[model samples]
Target: MDGDLRGLLPDDAQTRQEPKLMHPFKNFQLNNAIFAAIWLVFLAAVLVQVYLGAGYSARDKVWMTACVAVFSAFYFWAFGSMESHPSGWSQFSRAMLRWAVLLVIALASVPVIKTGVISYAPYLAAMLGFSVPWRKSLPIVAATGVVGTLAVWFVAPEDLGWSSLVLFATPFLLVAVGVFSQYDVSRYQLQHELDLAQQRENIATDVHDLLGHSLTVINLKSEVARRALHNNAEQAEKELKEIAELSRLALAEVRATVTQMRTPTFAGEVQGARRALETKGITAHLPERLTPAGEHETVFSWCLRELTTNVVRHSGANTCWVSVNADKLQVTDDGSGFSTDTVQNREGGLAGLRERVEAAGGRLIVRREHGLTRVLITMSGDSELMRDGAVVQEASE
Candidate 1:
């Protein structure tokens, strides 16, 4: 029942708090004019078919004209209100009721006038396609086609040929085409929404990883400085300076993370990782630079940042090593090695990192071997890393 009520409202009503004029017609103030023109054309067509095509008594003509007028009015009302209604049961019910009234009137009047009012089938089918679920509309449309064809066959057996078949089939064909176009539009909209959602998730994950690790380090240094202040003056001064430096770095990182447009390069990340590890009293073994022959710098930089963060936050190791090559990058820590269960339960960051790696046509692997917790990322030669690298190099040269 709730669903039915929701379906009676416009599509935008639930999403938009205030009404805004939409494209094509609303922006130009031409919607009413266009609808009026279309209705005029429809009315003219129906009058021509009734007055000229069908031979009837004056009384019957008047009745048929009244019926046509009523049918046209009902059709116009339904079409104009289509965008106001949500695409579900309420819209379908409204369309079906309109179709039912027209079908009954046309069928009943056929015996009196000796004329089958088959011309309106296309317009009725269009209404069904536009309003109802395609699956329901399709079967209904097929049934209409069969009944209309049979009616024509019985009415004039001598004229039971290709013309009758064409008349019956055209409406169904048109309805199918119209419905599929709507389906394509719906698919495009869904894809756009998914893309926007993915972008938001990526931004959130990046921000969390950036702030969480930096803040943890800053807190640890501040605590160390507090303890040293009571025992040793020189050591406390050194710790205090490091705390200030770490705070400044964190502030810069926060700014960069929020901007989202600039990504740290592999070299920059390696340097940053060394400083972070040193502050935590952990040994850092990192390469000076990584020159992989691909465009994958941003993804690699992100992976490096995430791995370094995990090492600082979770690993109790005294030493951390980062190795980068043409095809792969690995971060190893001789920390308290993590079990698969621990990683699954505690490592939400790795899941986001894994998605980023896979999107770049690379794979990320995490394992504990030889008492070392290792996070290895492998990239294919034809991956996004290479493509991005080439684009950057081209732009520079």
Candidate 2:
């Protein structure tokens, strides 16, 4: 492939992070046996034509065979260059040069092969379609058809009818094959790109939520521990121990998040949020006991964890409320209220949470009602969002 065609193809670096199971290319190369078979079928037809053509001496046949053998070598070399490679400019240059040699062989053999050599047009046009920009290739392939059609008329007028029509149509059809191949390869490139980007985003959101929640509690405990250190040794030691424990859990959770093996549960967040709020001298209204929450437990868990962090960090009120069920999770704080626009544009945890919620096919709605900063997450019950277990049914009250 040359520079223009290489732009449409995937590079080694682009595919490195892609999942093997997801990509369509078999071993990341064109199917070698199938391409080899296609070439052999065409070569056999030409060789049969040469063997049967009148007035050709045995020595002339020998020379024609050598030309074909050499052409085959160059053709395969050009194609094999595309096989799973760290393809650089030098490799692309070599592929293009091999194509030029193939074209030269086709033209030079016209005296012996006659119009039979025009059979090379389809292969040459396909190579052009795959190796150059489509705009540059369209006219080049058209010219090959014109030349081949004329060769059919002038070089062997005895065989001009259906052969000319077939010759013209074959090249365009092969070029169409090349165009479709490019579409498939481009789709693989974009799919890899999207998967890689999502991986990065997931790592970012997990880390931000983990550290933000963990550190906020640690900060509050540190301050509490400091105030009591001189007057009350036991209380200070307890806070210090809790800080040490939080650090360990945070470290473990970070590892799991990176590995994508861990998911937060509603119960875990309830405990964590309660600790964070209480440490900040804010009363927390939280659920009792962890239950087998429905399909989107991770999303619900994340919502609770993230919303509680916002209450502790931003809200200046005394009481905070969090409630959850299958369809929705709501968190409200009677603190310094915020504008709806602020939630939309807030940096850090909430912004990351909003992204996670939307990606899960759920919505995050934030507003203020009756001096309470209210956040409502309405979950989507789509089967795809179900992470682990069956959906739980809640009885109507």
Candidate 3:
């Protein structure tokens, strides 16, 4: 789990101690705009109620409008603070205080003014529901409902039975909206995290494959150079120069990997596989060129690299053959063939390749027959071409 966390965080992100500054309108500009528009609509509703509702004089309407303005300001401040300072308890407490003040003012105006000014109580309940956790917000929602009911009862005790229903139902519906809104926000965040994790996995896998192959070849050449240093100066010099060239290529590959522009062609992989096989005292037979266009190139190149690596690391084979065409690639090795258990327990490199191939709308098949292990990969929607006595075993992604 700790390793997963480390992989999820970028190098710079892991090193940073302080919290990064969150831009207010970075990814959520549309959401913020919609929220602001809703607040404006609420404010307009308050003013309209103040002007049209009965039993309120000019002076009472002016005082009610003043309170509504202050309430809107406090609500905006609380909302903005929640976005900016999301972690600390101090900001949460301050926002809660602002909400409490708005509720108090709304409840206090109930006994004095017999107008729709009391409707703001439910809006405060909904805001609290949106801003805080459900456990903390539920009591506030209940209190707002009670306050609204009392205000309705005070204004017209004769109509209290039916009028009070509106007071309770309005806040209840708004609280439901707030809960669903928070749920949607949480779901979006989870999906974003999943995407980030998948991206990191791909990068880590590519870098590991790239470095592992290059370093293995480099180590082999270095050993050869050391062995020939005393007896043959020219051979040792040639090996040393190749090592330097390989190191430069490795560096370029790393840079390209970081920029997400490193695409290993099937031709390049075939050449690399041959060189790697020869270094390990294994003979490799490969085509002169295999030009698979579009997506096939990428999938086949990775399959070649993975198969070659498996041959070197897992198979005790002296001879290996690679065949590639437009739609299919087959790698065969006369190795100590894998048993059913061994294939089932395959992990790391082979497993990663299986996932890559399957995700590209293709199937990966491994077979152990006639003292040879064969790997066959074909793209989806391709015609099935039969090989002599080869039973295809498809791997799941």
User: Which should have the higher lDDT, number 1 or number 3?
Assistant: 3
User: For residue 213, what is the lDDT in candidate 3?
Assistant: 99
- Residue pairs clashing in model 3 are none
Q: Model 2: per-residue lDDT, tens digit, 1-397?
A: 3446656667874555444434323222223323643654567777776789788889778878888887776566456444433333444354456557789987877778777777777777767667655666678778777777776887678888766656678778777777787776566556545645777798999999999999999999999999999999999999999999999999999998887634665665776787677656576666653544588887888788778887888778677777667777777777887677766876545778889989998888776645566677877543222211111111211
lDDT assessment of candidate 3: 0.69
How do the predictions measure up, each by TM-score?
0.49, 0.54, 0.51
Worst 10 residues of 1 by lDDT: 24-33
Candidate 3 least-lDDT 10 residues: 388-397
Candidates' lDDT values, in order? 0.67, 0.70, 0.69
Q: Which candidate, 1 or 2, has the higher TM-score?
A: 2
RMSD of model 1 against the true structure? 22.0
Question: Which 10-residue window in model 2 sums to the lowest lDDT?
Answer: 388-397
Write the number of the candidate with greater TM-score, choosing between 1 and 3.
Answer: 3
Alpha-carbon RMSD, candidate 2: 21.9
The C-alpha local distance difference test score for the whole of candidate 1 amounts to 0.67
Better of 2 and 3 by lDDT: 2
